[model samples]
Target: MNRTDRLLAIVLELQGKKTIRAEELAARFETSVRTIYRDMQALSEANVPIIGAPGQGYSLMEGYFLPPLSFTASEAVTLLAGAEFVQKKLEPNYGVHAESSKAKIEAVLPEQVRLEAEQVRATMRFFSAREAEGSRRERENMELLRQAMLDKRKIRFHYAKTTGPVLQRESTRVVAPYGLAHIQGAWMLVAACDLRRDIRHFRLSRMSGLEETSDSYELPPDFNLEAYRPRDDRELKVILLADPDIADRVRESDIYYIDAFEEHPDGLQIKLRVRRMEDILYWVLSWGADVTVLEPESLRSRVVKEAQKLLERY
Candidate 1:
């Protein structure tokens, strides 16, 4: 980038972080340390209020702030697209804020840039594939859970547990809601389950009659939602041979647990890793004769048994 842009970016970077070493800035901008020193000197001359300590690195003065900056057409389009996603995917409250944000951004943009951004954004669309009823319910649940989390209150809800294609059981749970996450187009709540005495994930679609309780609690200092990752011990391997005609379709389905796909002389070899036989049982059944299980005799037997059951029902 040009020196002017580099200087502006340096100030912005300083504004973001508490302190950064000269070597770090040099690597970030892809320039030599000597050049970075010269740039720092130039910034100081321009009265940018950059403070440098011998051991500590460079930082902006406490009260220093940047003036309003202009956005490029591409940048405006990106922001607008994000706002569009929020409007379509998130709860009603966020949708309103997203709409207002878009309006404010558009109001400040240059006419030419705004028009350009509009043209680009016109080619894109965002919509949920979920049924309207289901989507609305999840959004409502999300809104309630979000408020409960913010207010440091516990929540009570009825959650249904599913095994394979069948509903296993339903139970009421009172949990200290921690955070919400959207994964695979579904909303999940991560919370400390009072009954289980451990952290658990609850799918919003499976939740009903959610209500905030009068009880309040504090978030644990060691718990961080952003860094939390559930451990999965899906060691069961299931291999399938798919007919060439359906191989592409199977791949297109984007099954989350698929480990690898290989070319087989007969057709395609698809390897799957799952936590339980039930995890893949229904999916295998869905393909009918087009997919054949080649390993794990237990899964094969289960598939045959389910197929026999289907035949008996017919």
Candidate 2:
């Protein structure tokens, strides 16, 4: 970016954060520390009210604020689309705020820009993939869990494990709530499980009879929800040949573990990496004869056995 844009961005960054070091600004703007120092000097010369300390970094002066900035039509549309997604996907508490935010953004846009943004927004739509019953339950659980997290309380609930053996299907759990994550169209609670004595992720849809307990707990000092990423140990590689007719459908499904797709004379060659054979057994079964497991003799044997069982049942 040009120096003019960089200077304005630096001031905006300072306005947003409590303080930022020269190195941090340099990294954020993808420039050198020397350039950052020169930019700071230029900003000070322009009377931007940036206060710098020897070791404390830089911050905007108290009560200093930037005037309203204009947005391009595309930018306005992007913000509106984000607001719309939040309204449709998140719980009601956030949905209300998103609606208000959308209104405020629309109020500030130029009439022509607003019209263009609205036209672009109208071309797109957001819809919940979940059923009404599941969506309602998830929303209720999300609000309750959000409150529990804020209050630093433990919660008790009956959780149903959709996978695994039937005997271990359902169990009551008492957990110290940490945070929630929305992954692949589902809400998952990341918590400290009292029973397992470790952090676990529980799907909200599978939870029943959830209630906050009188007990309270403190979050771990080192744990940060925004920085948390579940460990992935998917080493097993499974290859499959999919019928050409169904290739488009498979691509549209957006299966998370699909590693690559290659065109073949017979059909499409699909490469999948997963944690275990069982992790993708059902998905493979769903495609029936259209998808043939080419490797991992174990998965192939399991599929044969399962198909035999189905035949016996019929």
Candidate 3:
């Protein structure tokens, strides 16, 4: 760890309700005891209320603190403002850290501008809701997959295809884990299933769990992820009139060629490509009255067929 992290670790270690000996910090930071003393002196010069006792080591007094890093007054305000916005909109996992940051800024803020910060914080609010992110299990599992990929270990897992039953897969005999990706609303783990194997994509939500083995695997030197995701394999072709309301979103991704549009009575016509019909169908349906599929008789037919079947069930 660098100097900033080393100091934070020292404070955290002390915060856990035990005096940390100078020698202990020296050993932890791989520095000499005299260097640690000099660091302590530096901490004190920065207004850290570190009280030292004979044989009892050192402790920080209440209201005294270690700087996350040295900051100018303007920098502190900017940091606190951004963090305050994040604190309002994000979940505890994200916002709680922002809270600590806010406190750190408040700790060193000068008396004159501190009230201004309070006023700003009192009036400020952040937009955007906390998205449903990965669960702890999901995060741990994903980390394991990353380690396995780097170590070239073989991995196994159960997978459920959308149209089929779940199957217990023993892919380690052939494949090597390559990468994990989250797109749209789903997470996909990509891998090469065998030597010279084509890249395969698996849905994480549909996966039961993962297993890794001691065995290592290798990929062809020329392997690239784009080689696996074929530009042509996108099976569904679509044409639509995009609602002007979501034109900004269209501008965000290269997926839709906006200039290719033709003016319609309602909106701009757009062409879209899809590897699978379901996802794009859901996406289009999300726009409600704003979008209409213009071409590809097969896709329209399938939608109508599904709607008819649903009506009967209803």
Candidate 4:
């Protein structure tokens, strides 16, 4: 971390504890003991009430507390910008929390810094890939699932899975909640499904009647999320030619796993190792004429058949 951030962290750490060993602080910050000593001296010189005990450690003088922190104008702007994005794009309740937290921060900031932050907020914006959003019920479900993950507890919920063109089925599931992620502007829960006997990703929006289970689960010792994901058993190598505008959108979205991308005079050529052909076909169709499946005649034929079905429906 930079010097300013490190100094702030040290102060916060000191505020939380009665005493801290110099060695402990050094190890935590990945710095040398000598550097920590220098930092303590610097804090002492700055009129901070740091009392030291020989061979013991250091502590703030009894009843001594620092005043509320003041942020630089640029720092205030950066913080406000991040909070604005979270408020605009994240879970509904989380967005509300962000707004409340931003208000608290602004209340403590200097007038000039607050004014600058407000100006920055007024000018900056963020956009989501999809227009549809999770309802308040979905956000509540996310909080329950998050609590389950934190407590190492199992969760029971009814999951609705799409089985056919116009049908879905709801079934009760008891799962060991592992993690939650925001992918492609939606929330998904990753868990070890007892019914499936494997790790699976379930869309939070599709879950209903969630309940925390009494059972506890032990986390697998060798489980790694990054390693567990990008799992494709039936990998199909395919290619696509995309307009520049659509290629940019693809890069920003989790619509496809791009293995390689090449720029050309006509457009961009994208190579991918995909799992589900139907998902890929629908994603390409969403781009309309901006994207073309250039290889794998089977995929092309499937898209054509789907298009024909659409024509018949119309």
Best model per lDDT? 1
- By the TM-score metric, which is better: model 2 or model 4? 2
TM-score comparison, 1 vs 4, better candidate = 1
Candidate 2 segments whose C-alpha is farther than 4 A from its true place: 1-4, 22-49, 164-168, 233-237, 273-277, 312-314
What value of lDDT does candidate 4 attain over all alpha carbons? Answer: 0.80
Candidate 3 pairs with clashing backbones? 174-194, 175-193
Residue 279 CA displacement from its true place in model 4, Å: 2.0
lDDT of 4 by residue, 1-314 (tens): 98767776887788889899999999999999999899999888989889999988988888887655788777887877788778765657778899988888888998988887778777877764444444555677887887788888999988887622323477899999888777766678889999999988898888888999899999899987766674566588889898977767777765446788889887888888866665467667777778888989888898788789989999
Task: Kindly list the per-residue Cα lDDT of model 1 for residues 165-217, writing each as its tens digit.
Answer: 69879999999999988887788999999999988999898899999999998
List runs of model 1 lying over 4 Å from the truth: 32-41, 44-54, 61-64, 214-222
lDDT of every predicted structure (CA atoms): 0.91, 0.90, 0.66, 0.80
Better of 3 and 4 by lDDT: 4
Measured by TM-score, the strongest candidate is 1
State the displacement of the C-alpha of residue 266, model 4, in Å, after optimal TM-score superposition: 4.3
* Per-model TM-score versus the true fold: 0.88, 0.84, 0.48, 0.73
Error of 1 at 306 (Å): 2.5
Clashing pairs in 2: none
lDDT of 2 by residue, 1-314 (tens): 99988888898899899999999999999999999999999989988898999998999999999965888899999889999888887789999999999999999999999999988888998876656776888888988998998898999999987543333378999999999888888889999999999899998988889999999999999999999987777899999999999999988877878999999999999999998787788889999999999999999999999999999999
